[model samples]
Target: MMGSRGTSAVLSRAARMRQKLQSSLEASALDIEDVSYQHAGHAAVKDNANETHFNIKVISPKFEGQSLVKRHRMVYDLLTDELNSGLHAISIVAKTPTESGS
Candidate 1:
């Protein structure tokens, strides 16, 4: 583990981000995967093995009419705090229900 507190803090932040996105986006489906292990030795990562990167997939009707840039921005905006606090990167896959092949 990432010095215990570091891992817990990172996980807590990610959980909070998930909660916020779930509530704010009203997503039908949402998945947030901690991808820090994939970047364990990168310079941007200062927290040893902490959760510094994430891959997020969300499906919501809210995304139905949004541009891709706009949809990405919406997620980034919601995660401003995490970004400020050592969340080095994010990959977002936002889709409407229909766009998700549902």
Candidate 2:
């Protein structure tokens, strides 16, 4: 069923975030897990907090030659908006396929 304001087609926040990361990094593999439940009552600003915490594991050739800092920065750049809008925290494991033993 479509939403009255045409928002029904909009992907969930986590799905959209995953899509953005995949596109931005050309990720060979991506796993985005919503870990908000694990951090109950841990958020600074708890208003409208949906999908605030996450654990992301990404394997991509784009990260092959990058330093850990650079790799994390790349992922953070892709999620700028989410971070700004109260994405409380994220645990990111960014690696190349080779490094990931995959």
lDDT of 1: 0.88
lDDT of 1 by residue, 6-93 (tens): 6545457678888879999999999999988999989978859587899999998889889999999999999998899788999999
Whole-model Cα lDDT of every candidate shown, in order = 0.88, 0.85
On lDDT, the candidate that comes out on top is 1
Model 2, 16-102: lDDT tens digits are 688789988999899999988787776474854678889999999999779999999999999998899778889999999999887
Count clashing residue pairs in model 1. 0
Off by over 4 Å in 2: 1-9
- Judge candidate 2 at residue 74 and give its lDDT: 95
